[model samples]
Target: MSKKWSIAALVLYVVYAVGMYFYIFHGASGGVPATLKGTVADPQTFMTERELYLSDDYSKIRNFLFFVVTPFEWLVYFLILFMGISRVFEKWADTKWRLFKNGAYLFLLNLFTTIVFYPIDIYRYSLSKEYGISTQGFSSWMRDYVIDFWVNFGTTLLIVLVLYWLIQKSAKKWWLYAWLLTIPFAIFMMYLQPVVIDPLYNEFTPLKDKELEAKILSLADQADIPSDHVFEVDMSEKTNALNAYVTGIGGNSRIVLWDTTLNNLTDEEILFIMAHEMGHYVEKHIYIGIALYLLSMLVGLWLISKIMPWMVSKFGRVLNIEKVSDIRSLPLFLVLASFLLFISNPISNTVSRYQETRSDEYAMELTGDAEAAVSTFQNLAKAGLSEVNPPWLVKIFRYTHPPMLERINTIARYTDKNEVETEQQAE
Candidate 1:
């Protein structure tokens, strides 16, 4: 067999074995059947890892579509459309939309792009619904999209203006200045996202289950995280997928759990997941991610500063752009940014997977309940319809967390070691 496919088969076998162990254990113990718990509430049940993870033809097809669609979105739809628009408006390039031709083009560019690409977005959402992941209605999805569009509209407008302003002021070292400015600007945006922007999409409230809240807070306390920052978001409106995340920076930072996760998981499982999230805050991964991204942007902007001038000389007239900052140059600017983003994906994902694996260990250490860690991941894999082992390319390019099989194995190893140590102490 080919190496990649062989590796895929081996990992998939691991997933099946682990899943079978859980199914048999739960069945024998009379632990809550997934159906009774409303965990896998659909009529089409997943009984084994092959069924639960590997055998989902819909998800695999959709994922493959994503591998195709993303580059199309970035390189084709986003790029070619803008290029076409600029050429179409060739005469008006300098004078037609004179007032709106500068920084305002950022907003117009995004609006046009989103409109052209909105079908792709909706098709993706539709696929999620078909696969039983999304619970959102079409109208509700559109409403959220509108809110997202305006948010982007505002941010893109500001980013383009500042970028251009830097370009005009310092022709030679503008990229360096902009790169430095991006660090603060990026952090400032992160600080605002949880507070100002997230509220528009979903409702957030202090977790109402007091006993559960206290347990979560205790874990936070153990981790030296502030108790008040843990909030539960109403995610059941939009999705059935389980998740928790830490967002914002400094005082604005908060830990958020999807209500879907709360409703689906046991309290013990929930605690382990929350502790894992707390580890992110404890480790300051958000800051680390921001720093890494800004560092990449520094390199990306510098490269653009070098290459953009040359592109302008070649395609300037066709693109209705005179220089790097012409606002009309936004598409080409994104071309460079997107290329950098594509290459950086694996690097960033590798760093994230390391942090995630460490956080898994941290949670195991904090809770010392290996069973809960195992169960937590098992249920999460089921909840999200995650392929416990995707193909090799997907693992490197797509996943930010280690596969479910690897995570379960990691916890089992730690669990086994702990038991051995206890037995030694007893002797």
Candidate 2:
């Protein structure tokens, strides 16, 4: 029966992979947009021949790994359950304090999985280094890796312990209870992240360029955003990639620019980028995102509640688990949750892309600088070696923001529209 399940898992993943290949490479909508033809938004303009070749290679491998990793993780979970590794952890965790014992189990489980996944993680880092994306030394990279492991382990341990406690309290409706708790917990994390969690990995300080800081604050003031300061993180030490974002919640919220961005972009281009991020704040994308997340979790956890018992009843022996509330049953729960999340990628990405487009439009309106916006995106593509036009399935599965081609073309369209409007007003 375990063998049958394993075979079924492999077959299902194979079918998904085959479908993905055809959908990405041979789908009907694969081509440059109508907006880009004969325009400066050509892909050829974005990168040198050597850089383009390197970017294409990097994108293909990254996309391939995206599909492979999820199924691999699911299978690893199954293997742990089938091989009774969870039971071994349970034994090692035997103690008087149930929470402590569960923590031990979680730590052991995470340690095991970390070891199993280390090669993939390290290889990803190596790939970034090879592509000139990452500048950190291997030892520094390893330090960050260790920090990430402990952080994730601690977070998972806390969440899982609460989940199990909820299960003990109400086996039938624990998912509902857990889902409710998730809202406040998520908000708490958001509030704490910028001040606590983020500082652990990188140094963030007030933007040192007082002139640029004043410009950014002035932009914020015009946008009616309460921000009085701009923060910059020293990312040039670790990465060549450029990024800026608004993070945290309420008073904790602030705009942050990567030092790489400040170093690489002109003042006008930086303002355009900053305006784009400020759009997210003005339009309340953060709140909307939180609401959407809760809604998805509400439905997903409800489905898990129904499916977990059936699995436990039917394959309890094969999976070496007795019941849904058993801590050892975590691997099965994770497998189900992950599978659901994987299949929902396209839906989530569609919503994200829409939000990003709206933000882009808002930025164009606020900045009224089409040339700056265009140049900013062009520089972004060059800096990151980004593939401006990727496959259809890649857009659906991987793209949260519009492709660079689409963004630059949109700026062109916006420019033309604004010029026509100005002429009409004069007439």
Candidate 3:
């Protein structure tokens, strides 16, 4: 029965993955309209044919990887579970010292998973290198990869320690307790990420362009964001892609710009982008996002608590998992959580798109420069090689912001509306 279930699941996943690949690569249509010609949003007008080709190639491969990676990771965990590799790690970790035992198990599991996925990581790096998207040397990239591995392992260890402790304390309500603990832990991580974590990979310094800094500070003042610093990160060493963001909370809160952005965009376009990040702050999107995540985690954990036990009851003997609380069952928890998160991508992405739309609108209002807004989007699309309009499934699963086409059109419409209003007032 377990063999049948596993086979059935694999078949379903293969069908779904292949169907999505064909739908995106073959069935997807992104034909441009005649009206878009000569507009800033028009790919044919704006991007060279070589650029367009690279964009299409990168998009297809990226979409394919997105469809494949999570399911493939789940299968890896399932294989480990099925073959009792996790149990082997558990036995090897059975030392007299409790701390040593727990740490050893976690380290072994993390190491195994990281090793298995290293090839995929290298392939991703090679993909970026091939397309001229990444600028980092292989050594620097490997350093970052090592940093990520340790960071992930450390966080996983912490969470597992807390979770298993809770489970042992109260099997009936451990998920509830874990959820409560996660709220503060999540906030704490956000608070520290800007100060303690981000500097590990790249250097960040105060914005060098004092004139532009003053302008950004003025926008921050207008937005009532109490930020005194604008950060400029050295991303030229890593990638050619342009990016900027608002990060941290309260005292740590600051606006960050990639050096590539500063080098590529005009002051006006930069101001529009800065205003958009400020808009996220003014609209309190970060807090709202945290709230939504906590709500989802609350429900997700509760569901896992109910479903995991049932799954163990049905398939424990086949999979070699003794019970929910067994240390060997960590992969099972990860699989369930991953599945839940994957299925919720559309909902989470929709909320993100909505917030981003609001920020784009606020940026238009705050900057009062429709031309800058449209040009900023155009430059962004060009620098990133982003398709103006991706397929709907891509938008649903992947896009946090509105499509480039939608963004530019929204700004154009806003400009037209304002011009009509001005004409009415003059009459």
Candidate 4:
């Protein structure tokens, strides 16, 4: 009887694994069917004005599949929760029940913390703790958090509602309509984010060192980039991580130097870092990225709408919901989204890795200081506690940037030509 039971358990595990593999990798186009097409609209045409050409019959089928697939995806989350519980019990075998109780307690603790934290903690603990970078403390952090939360929450709700209305009211081409709705919101977010949203986290002060500022501006001028001001961001209030970036689009674009970056890196390293960021702008990577993301989201939403209905019927029975859009049915929707994200993680990582490499190449060309670039990456690795080497498959599937060793090697190959030549000369 025990042997039979053991065999049954093994079979169940195999079935579960097989089901997950298909759900993650094969569900969308492999087994399920859907059609998606984009219109050839004028580049200058506003997204709101464009129409996505999708078949009406396909739309109904897509909605049905979305409902069907949702519950299987939610089961994945249930499995995760179970595995987490099991791991905790294994770690505290002597007090297994106590550990479970503690897990419950921690969940409550975090829930309570969300009421007081979330937006404010973004400043207090995130920005202020960086030694030279962040000067913010508890009181200031609290004030910033509260104001940011309400403002951001209100803005997000407004955007979501507007988008939902656009989808419901506009062209039968929902994807096209959704894309149009996204354009103004995207522009607004880009403009308001740095000026209004960022200030809630850190103080932005005009960069003080005229000489350094002049040097940076000179570099930008030589690159034929137009910018009016450079500002120092108080990132130290939140994290010790050093970073710098050029952000915004068109006329709103600006260079932001993190206080942590200013504190830790040499001017040459900073210059190289800025050069990499500039590469993103000069190469039109930012615009390309935005367009690519919007397109991908449209496709994903279309796919989801197809699978969601069948997912709902299957999972809804468990959740006691009759329809997919029932407010109580949100957990099922969340589960489906999670499954889709997990399945798409590798694809997303590959795209990002390619973009990062291209940007790195552009940066190297601009800075012409491969050694400084290499050193900058090394410093980042040390600061972030990043693993220097990872398995090739792991890196390919999971990494946004190339592994530290690979980046270092690439830079070293370019910078160490003299050492290679010296050996050849001796030979």
Candidate 5:
């Protein structure tokens, strides 16, 4: 209903198109390699081959569908549906949630919106299943999905209430105050993510293999991180993908490996992976990442402050809204936020990619094992079904880690053990 919202949406779509064109043709990561020096190995083995592998025709289709088609569908079809549900159901002209308070209305609106998004989500999950990327059963996935929806609904409703209250209180300066508040709230959420949120779906325990745990602890010791224990999550119960990462903040932080990672990868490969995870802390990427994102989000909220009043002015009367403080106009605000998020994706992904690059370098330097790094990626690609040199379009939007070929090449370049040893000896 708002042309201001429509304009923001148009800009997002146009940028997406341009991004696709440039990414596919020019690529985001510069210096495209002429060839991959390594060999392709069987998916079951952690061994490397002399030849490199590319996405097969099937994989290309999967990539296209996942990265391009899915988002495009979200933009064109689901977004409209999403906004319509928000606009219509937000009023609650039909029913009530027990007491039927404003929070209750917000809950229905949010729940409806999430429900509208679910079919598309299920379809995407189906796509993942088809590609052998997900082993989650339909029932189990739906149960998790429902749990996530309720958790998010409560949190979002509270935030929406706070935001509108702020809007009412300040009228013109609410965005500034909200931005100030967001910094700590976001950090708190990050601090709680591993402890409060992650355990809901996955069960975590101390890493069972003492030899491997000791190796990990030794790596942590070398990194000067006081991590006493390494953790393993039973991810094999849900999906076949392999991963290991560091999470939480302060004393709650843990280095977590998926059971699948332990089962599928050798100690050497897992060590390389653990080193990569530890690199984030060693290089202070966690703090840096949060700072970068917080700044980006601050800028975004500033933009929202500038744009929202314009949206209110353009459609205030038509949408039956008199001012920016009206909770009824939250749907329009959310649409604008979605557009901003779309526009920010590339920038955010670029920052993440750069940090990942730093971690990869640190891992290679710390582990002093080029063979392990290379094989680590090879084994991971096998488990995750990641393509070497994923299409540039997919790479720009979807990849958080550097491409397999690029990382392999970087690791391969770290062949001089003397350099690593020299650095370690100095340390």
Candidate 6:
């Protein structure tokens, strides 16, 4: 009976996977619109068009997908919970009722910990204790988490409420109209996020070293990137990760470096990292990334709308929810999103890897120091405990950036090419 049920479940999962794939990849009537094509002609106009298209498409699809996948998600969660409880019961000779009781206790315990203690554990054990990283102890970490949770959750709830309101009040062409309504809110969020959202998570202060700041400014000048100041963020509050990024658009744009990164890396290495970030800015990766994600969300929503009815029929009763608006339905939408994303993983990763390679090329060109970049790559790999080499399939399916060895080899090749070109020019 167990084997039979397992087979049945497997068949259902396979069907879901196929349905999800078609829904995401095929549901869109056409590719990205021609108007939205290429890099932004003007940043303001580009942002406007992008937000309009995204808001409209996302609303329609989100409503559809939310209704479709809510039930299946509930079923999966319940099944996993049941199986885990059953295993624990078998070891203790507990009756079915007793097993359930214990399971309920354990579930609540874990949920509470996830809500409360897990954040503390992550900071104390994972972030603060690490060497060469910023030291944020438990109290500070907890304070940050509370602030972040409320800020993020409130923002999300507000967005959802607005979306729901749009769905209920607007006509079928609501998405088109909704975009115009939501653009101001979107822009406000984007602008406010760097100043308000980020400071809640980490301390942002001006980079203090005059000489290093001058060097970075010189590099930025060479790259033709206009920026007022390079600020350092106290990122050691979270983890021992080293990162630098360029944020904002147009005049609002700035460079942010993690304090941990600044502490651990040499000045030249820091320059190379900044160069990589500048490459992202110069290449307009942020704009391109936002556009791609917006498009994906639209398609994903469309697919979800198509699949909800069948999903609800199969699994809705188990969740004790009959309607899509029960709030219980939210998990269902998330599951469908996850399932579709799992299948689309390869395509998405490939796009990211390609962009990363382009950024790497840009960084190398800007820095004119392939060896320094290579060393920085090696150091990052070691510090992060990243696999030195991953299998080809894993690289294709899972990796966002090229593997460490591939990046090193590419840098070496570029260096050799540059050296040969220089010698030829001298002759």
lDDT of 1 by residue, 1-427 (tens): 2234335545655565455444333322212335334333221333464554433555466556645555555554233433456444333434555345554555556666787888878888988887778999999999999998888888877777777778878878999988888877887888899989999999999888889988988888989887574789999999988998878877887878899999999999999998898878778887788878888888888888888898778756654567765555667778778877877788988999999998998899899888788777777767677766555556677789997767876787788899899999999
- Checking candidate 3 for backbone clashes, the offending pairs are none
Write the residue-wise lDDT of candidate 6 on 1-427 in tens digits. Answer: 4344445665776676566445543452323335534422212222345444443344333323433344344445444323343234233433356334333433443343346445434643453244323356768776976776567556655654454445446524334454554556666666677787787677788898878999999999999989779999877766666788887665666788888788888998899989888888788888787677666766766676556545656655543334443233444555676778767778888888778878888889988887678678856754454433444444555578886656766777788899899999999
Model 3 regions more than 4 Å off: 1-12, 33-38, 97-99
lDDT of 5: 0.72
| Candidate 2 local lDDT, 1-427, one digit each (tens) | 7677767777887887787665544553334677666566775665688987787777777777887788889988998888788889888988988789888888888999999999999999999999998999999898899999989987898899999889878989999999999999999999999999999899999999999999999999999999877899999999999999999998999899999999999999999999999999889999999999999999999999999999889889889899887788888888999999998899999999888888888999999998899889988887887778788777888888888888887887888899999999999
**Decreasing TM-score order of the candidates:** 3, 2, 1, 5, 6, 4
Best by lDDT: 3
Candidate 3 TM-score versus the reference: 0.96
Predicted model with the maximum TM-score? 3
Mark the regions of model 1 whose C-alpha exceeds 4 Å error after superposition. Answer: 1-55, 77-84, 87-100, 314-322, 424-427
Worst 10 residues of 4 by lDDT: 36-45
- Candidate 2 error regions (>4 Å): 7-38
By how many angstroms RMSD does model 2 differ from the true structure?
A: 2.0
In the order shown, the candidates' Cα RMSDs to the true structure are 9.8, 2.0, 1.6, 17.2, 5.1, 14.8
TM-score of 2: 0.95
* Cα lDDT computed for each candidate against the true fold: 0.73, 0.87, 0.89, 0.58, 0.72, 0.61
Per-residue CA lDDT of candidate 5, range 1-427, in tens?
5456556666787787667655554554322354532343333234234112322433554554555553554454334433454345445533443224447657766666566667768887886677666888999898899889878887787678788888878877888888888888988998898988898888889989999999989988998988988889998877878999999989889999999999988898899898888889988988988888788778887788789789668755545555776555666567667768766777778888888888888987788877778778887776666666666556776677777777776765666566787899999
Worst 10 residues of 5 by lDDT: 46-55
Candidate 3 lDDT, tens digit per residue, 131-227? 9889999999999999999888888889898888788788889999999998999999999999989999899999999999999999889989898
Q: Against the hidden reference, what TM-scores do the models get?
A: 0.83, 0.95, 0.96, 0.64, 0.82, 0.68
Worst 10 residues of 3 by lDDT: 1-10
